[model samples]
Target: MPMEIRLVRIDDRLIHGQVATVWAKVTKVNRILVVSDDVAKDILRKTLLKQASPPGVIVNVITIDKMISIFNDPKFNDFKSMLLFTSPRDARRVVEGGVKLDTINIGGMSFSDGKKMITNAVAVNSEDIEDLKYLNEQGIKLEIRKVVADNKVYMMDLLKKEKMI
Candidate 1:
């Protein structure tokens, strides 16, 4: 069997309380792949994320290319993973690089300069909107929910309501 990618989520916070606790349980994934070049290079953040991992779940901070490579390798087929990306562009890159993902959860994109709030937790700039639209156009389901219990909202609908698309 191929590597089972249980969930693909985009959250700028990466691994945090909600992710390490709630998401890991909900996804039933043994591995959490933090697929980001920036975080992979930051030793402090990488160590922090590893320390923040859930009891049984293994966390790996790796670049986009490394994720693509390992994901394609047959040797890693036993991994049931939940991939975390800091941006829609990164998720798009991994998808375009040949990771077969059908849905991406927009967990949290914190308020930042030059970004407009779509929801209480999600803020997106023009570039983010573009990348999100590209993923939507590629027939990927974009869901917005901070936690598994929250009602899932469609990203495109929020974009349309905000007049972003």
Candidate 2:
């Protein structure tokens, strides 16, 4: 059984305006799996996110563990799905745990005090950069593109320019 999963966008602000407006429309995805341990346990946030989703779209707030299990399961192989993660660490963990996928899109990772700004839209803390390097080392194609319209930026290019990786 083969699955049709495309464009795993990593954005901390799950189910936001950008996601609903740009990604959902551009990708034409009907199902969104919010793969995060935090949201999975928080009933309030989960309910709000589910309510915020556009009609005809199904949203599932699940943990990384659940995602790993589901990815390995033979049943979901027939489903057309889109996976969303909140952070680079979670993304790296999912891949390291054997959730085999090719490319990941870095959508909007906000800046913190210690984070080095990669682009106008993307910022990276040390841990986040390390996670990206780990994903790159694993042969996963990582690109930084805020919206469907923006030009794609490779992690290696950003890393080299910033001297992080």
Question: Which parts of model 1 have CA positions greater than 4 angstroms off?
Answer: none
In order of appearance, the predictions have TM-scores of 0.97, 0.92
Tens digits of per-residue lDDT, candidate 1, 35-88, equal 999999999999999999998999999999998888778998989899999999
Between which residue pairs do clashes occur in model 1?
A: none
Q: Name the top TM-score candidate.
A: 1
Tens digits of per-residue lDDT, candidate 2, 1-165, equal 445677697988888877776787777777788999989999999999998786677888999988888885777775567788989999888888888778899888888899878888788888998898888888889998877888888977888988886
